[model samples]
Target: MKPGRNMRLAGLMRKEYLQVLRDPSSIAIAFVLPVVLLLIFGYGVSLDATNIRIALVIEQPDNIARNFAGSFDQSPYFAPRSFSSIQEAETALRRAEVDGIVWLRSDFGSGYLQNTSPPIGLIVNGVDANTARLVEGYVQGIWFTWLEQQMELAGKKMTSPVQLEQRIWYNPAVRSTDFLIPGILAVIMTLIGALLTALVIAREWERGTMEALLVTRISAPEILLGKLIPYFFLGMGGLGLSLVMAQFLFHVPMRGSLWLLLASSALFLWVALGMGFFISTVFRSQFVAALVAMVSTFLPAFILSGFIFDIRSMPVIIQGLTYLIAARYYVTILQTLFLVGDVWSVVWPNAATLALMGFFFHGVVYHKTKKNLQ
Candidate 1:
C-alpha cells in the first residue's frame, strides 16, 4: 500500500469507530463501565471502617471496662455501648445491631490492675471474615496498648508474649484505594474491552456481514488486529482517566516509572481483549458473552487477586488458586509503579508475568479464531 492508500487506514478506523458508536450496548461499556467500576471499587470495597458499634456487656462496672469502652469511644471507628448485662448485648449481637460484643469478667477490674490475668470476652460477627479480623485486631491492639502504657509509667517494661510486627511493602500506609486502583485498572479494562469486543464481533457475525468480509482472503489475525486497534485506543483512554482519578481524587501517588505503568496496563488490556474475543467466538449473543466475560474477569481481579487482600494469609489451597488470576501479578505492578519507583526486583518480575499472561490469552484467542475459521 502507498502513502495515499495508508490514509485509508484512517477511514477504516473511522468506520470501526462509527460502528462501535452505533451500537448502544458497546458505547455503554466504553463510557459507563468505568464510572460503574469506580463507584463499586470506591464505595463498596473498603478497609477504613468507622463507627463500628460494639456492645460492652459489662458484668462489672470496673475501671478496666469503663476505661476500655472510653478508649473505644475516642477512636473514630468504634462506637461503644455499655450494657449492665450480657443478655442485652447478646440480643444486640443477634439482631446485628452491633458488630462485636465485649464482656468483662467479675474480676476484670482487680485482675487487670494487679499482676493476675483478666479474662475478657470478645464475640464478633463472623459473617464477613475480613471485617471480623479487623475488629479483632483493633480491640486487641487497643486493650494491649492501654495496658502497656499503664505498665510503662509504673516502671514496668512489658514486652508482648506473642508479638507480630507487620510491615506492608510498597504501600506502607495501606490505603484501600492505593491497593485497589491498580486492580481496578485491570478489572475495568477487562470489562470494557472483553465485553465490548464480544458484542461487536458477535454483532458482525449475527448480522451476516462477517461472511462477506471472510471472502476477501484476509487472515483472521489481520481482521483481529484491525478490530483491536480501535478498542485498544478506547481502553487506553479509559486507563489514562482512571490514573488521573487515582492520583487527584483518591490521592494515591504514582512513584514508579510511567513507562512501566503504561506497559503493564497495555498488557492487561491485551489479555482482557483476548478473554472477550474467546467468549464472543464461542458464544454469539453479546449479552451472554459480556455477562460471562465480566463475571470471570472482574470477580477474580477483585477477589482472588492480591490487591486489597493478602494471599499469604489465606489457606495453602487458596494461595495456590491465586496464580490463575492475571490481575494477581498486575496488582503487584500497580503498587510497585505507584509507590516504589524503579524497584526492578518487583517491576521486572511482574512485568514479565503481565506479558506472559497477555501472550497466553492472545494465543487462546488466536487458536479459537483459527478453529472457528476452519
Candidate 2:
C-alpha cells in the first residue's frame, strides 16, 4: 500500500512538472518576474531626498541677499536657480522647474542685521508632502547655519545650550535601498507563491482535467501535495535569484544566517502557496482566482506591509487591518534578518504566525478538496 501511494505521488508530481514546463507564463512568474520587480522597485523607487531644486528670488540685489543665496548654493542639498523677480521665480515654480521658492524681500538688507526674523518668504510645492517637508527642514537648517556664520563674521557670539547628536541604528548611512530590498524580496515571494498557485487548480478545472483526476485513485492529499511540491521549489528558486540580485546587483547586505533566512522564507512561502490553493479551490475560474490573488496578496503586501509607509502613522482601523496580511509578518522577518541579524525576539513570533496561517489555509484547502471529491 505504501509503495503504491509513493508511486502514485511520484507520477502526479511528474505530471505537474511537465505541466509547469509546458506553460511559459508559469516559468515567467517563477523566474523572470522576480528580476523585473527587483529592478523596478530597486532603481525606480526612492525615499531619499537630495539635490532639491529651488528658485531663489532676490527682490533687492544686495550683499545680504547674495550672501544668503551663496549659502544655499554651497549646500549639497539645494540646487539653487537665481531669479531677478518673484514673478519669474513663481513662473519657474508653476512650471515645476523648481521644488520650492526662496524669496528675500526688499527690506532684507536692513532687517536681517537687526537680530529679528528676516523678511524671507518660502513657497514650497506641496504636491509631494514628504519631499516638501524635507525641503522645508533643509531650508530652515541652511538659514540657521547662515545666521550663525554671519554672527561669527560680525564678532558676535552665538551659543545654543543644547546640541543634538543623531545616531541611526541598523542602517548607519540610512540608504533606502538597504531598507527597501528586503521588503521587495517579501513582495516578490508573495507574488510568485500566491499568483502562480492561484492559476494551478483553476487551470485544471478549466481544462477538464480535475474531473479526470478525480475518477482516478488519487486522494485529495496526494493531489494537493503534488500541486504544492513543484511550486514550492519554484518559489524557492525565485527567492534564491532575488537574494542574489539584491546582494550582487543592488548591494544589499545580509547580516543574519542564510539558513535562518531560508527557513523563515520557506514558512512564508508555504502560507502564500496555501492561500493560492485555497483561492483556486473555492473559485474554479482561472481569471477569478488570479484577480483575487493579486487583490488579496500583492496590493496588501505593497501597502500595508510597511514596505513604503509606516504602519504607526496610518489610521487606527487601517493599522488593525494590517494584522491580517501575511506579508506584514514576513516583511518584518526579512528586514530584521537582512538588517539586524537573527534576533529571535523578532523572528520567533512572526515565524509562528506564518506557520499557523499556512496550517489554517492548507486545512481549508484539504476540507474543500475532500468535499469536491465526494
Candidate 3:
C-alpha cells in the first residue's frame, strides 16, 4: 500500500532470497529433489505388464493346434513355454513359473468344423486377481481372433449379436507412465511449495530472527508476503525442472498451452505455499512444522489427489474427503494440461478452486500472524 510498506516488503523478500542462497538445504529441496524424484519414479515405476510367462499344452499337436499356439508366441503380451501335459503345466503354475495355461484338447481340430464349440481350457493363477483377469482376457482375445481367422479362411462368416469398436483417447498407447508423470509433477509441486515455506517462520523463530522482524515497523501482511515471495519463485524453479524432465527426458506429451499450464501451476503453487505458511505460523518448531507439512500436504497430495489410484474407485467416504485436498484439483488440472490440452471446461473449474483455496489459506495466515509473536 504505502511506499514505506512497499520498501519493507522488498527488503524482506531480498533478505529471504539471501537466506535461501545461504541455506544449501533450500537449494537441494528446490532443485535436487525434483531431479532425484523424477529419475526414480520415471524409470523405476511402471504399471504395464509385458512378457508374461504362460504354458501351452497341445493334446494332439495337430496343424490347427500348432497354428493357434503360434499366435500366443507372436503376441507381445505372452511368452509361451510348451508343456507336454496338463499335469506339467499345473506344476509350473504351482511353482509360479507361468501365469496361465492354455490347453487345446485332442478334439480341437474336429470341433472347429463341428456344431459343438471347441474344447479349449484356460487355467490362470488367481493369487494376483488383477493379473489373472488380464491373462484370461488376453487368452479370450487370442481365441476369438483365431476363430474369426478360421472362419474367414473357410469362407464362412462368424455370427455375432453385436460388434464393438473401441476408441482410447488422451493416451492411446496406454503407457501408464504417460498418465503417471503429470500426477507425479503435481505431487512434486506440493512438496516443493509446501515443504519449502513450512520451515520459514519456524526457522526464523529458532534463529531469533523473527523477534528482530517483529521489532520493525513492517506490518503482518508485509511480513507474510516477504516470507512467501522468495519461496514462490524457488518452487516455480522446481516446477520448471520437473516440466523439463517430463518433456525431454520422459517424453510425456504436453498438449496444452504452456502459458495455461504455468498459470494454473502458479495458482496451485500459491495454494500449496499458503498451506505451508499456515503450518509454519501455527507451529513454531521447525521439526514440528516440517512433519505437519508432510502429513497434511504431502500425504493428501499423494493419496487423495488420485495420483496413482482412481479417486472414484475409492470408498465413498474417502472420495468425499478428497474434495478438501487442494492437490486433487491440481492433479486434475495437471492431467488435463499434459494429456488433454487447454480444455477450459476442466482447467477453469479446478484453477478457480485453487485460487479460492489460495486466498482462504493466505487470509488465515495473515489473520493469525501477529507482530507481537504470540
Candidate 4:
C-alpha cells in the first residue's frame, strides 16, 4: 500500500535535513555570510560627516575678528587652521588641505561697532556637494551664535523677524550606522533565503537527485514543502545570528516588538524562498540559477530597497518599480522596528504586501511544479 501523505512529507523533509547537514556551503552562506556583511556595513561604511577642515583668514587681527575665529575653533564640527592671508587660504583649499575657507574682512570689527551686519565670506570646495552644504551650515550656525553673544555683551537684544527652534526626531544623533545596520538585514535574508535555496535545488537537479525524487510516489506539494521547511529554519537561524550581532556588536536599538519583527521576517523569508524555488525550477543548471538569483533578487534588493538611497529621491518610474521588489517592503519594516517602535501603520501594510507576494510566488511555483509532474 502507498504511504500516507503525512508520512511521505515527513520522510522527504528528513532527507532534506540530511542533505543540509552534509553541505558545508549551506551553513557558511547562512551563518558566515551574515557576519562578513554586518562587519563591512557596520564598521567600514558611514554617512555621518564630522571634523570638517576649514582655513580661517583674518585681514585685520582685531578683538572682534579674533573672537569670531575662536567660535569656529570651539565647534566640534570644524577643525580650524589660521591663515595669514586669503591668498594662502585659497591655495590651501585648492591643494585639498582644507575643505572650506572662512574670510573676515578688515571692515568686520567696524561694522559690528556701527551696529550693522558684518559680511563674512565663505568659500567651500564643491567637489562633494553634500559635504559642502554641511560645512556651510555649520559655519552659519557659528556665526549666528557669535553674533548673539556680541549683542548680549553690548547690553542689547539682536532684532530678528523670526526665531527658529529645531528638533531632530527618530535618529536624533543621526548616526548612519544605526540607519544602515537594520537595512543590511534585508540583504542578508535575501542571500540566505533566495540565493542559498536556488543554488541547492539547482545542484540537486544537476546531480540527477531531483529526477530520482520526481519518479517517486511523492506529490508535488509534498516535494515543495520538503524543500521549503528545512530552508525556512535555516534562514531563521541566520536571522537570529544577524539580530544578535546587530544588538550586541553594533548596538542598534530594537524599539519594536520582538515578536513582530520575527513575524515580518518570516513573511519576507517565505517570499524569498518562493523566489528561489521559482528560479531553480526554471533553470536546472546551478550556475545559471545562482546568476539569475543574484541579478533578480540581490541586486534589486541592494539598490532599490531604500537601504542606502531614499526611495522618494529616485525617479518616479524607479519609485514605482520599487513597489515590486519584496526587499523594499522588508527594509522599511526592519528600519521601523529597529529605529522606531511598534508603529502598526508602517508595519501592517508592508507585512500584508509581503504575505501577498509570498502567496503569489509559492502558488506560481506550485502550479509550475505540478505541470512538470504531469
Q: Is candidate 3 or candidate 4 better by lDDT?
A: 4
Clashing pairs in 1: 255-338
Best by lDDT: 4
lDDT values, one for every candidate: 0.78, 0.91, 0.90, 0.92
Candidate 1 has an lDDT of: 0.78
List runs of model 1 lying over 4 Å from the truth.
Answer: 1-8, 59-65, 112-114, 152-169, 216-222, 308-324, 360-374
Model 1 C-alpha RMSD vs. true structure (Å) is 3.4
Top TM-score model: 3
lDDT of 4 by residue, 68-93 (tens): 99998788888899999999999999
Model 3, global lDDT: 0.90
Q: lDDT tens string, model 3, 1-374?
A: 88988888999999999999999989998999889888888998887767889999999898888999999988999999999999999999999999999999999877876767787899999999888998998899989898889889989998999987899999999988898899988888898889888887789889999999898898888888898889889999999989999999999999999999998888999999999888988888999999999999999999889999899899999999999999999999999988998899988888888899999999998888888957
Q: Write the per-residue lDDT of candidate 2 for residues 1-374, one digit (tens) a residue.
A: 59988999999999999999999999999899999999988998888887899999888878988988899878888899989899999999999999999999988987876757677899999999999999999999998888888889989867789876788989987889999999988888998899899997899889989988888888889988888999999999999999999999998888999999999999999999999998888888999999999899999999999998999999999999999999999999999999999999999999999999999999998888862544
lDDT digits (tens) for residues 175-241 of candidate 1: 6767676667777776777777887888788887666556655556666777788999888888888
Q: Residue pairs in steric clash, candidate 2?
A: none
Model 3 lDDT, residue 213, Cα: 87
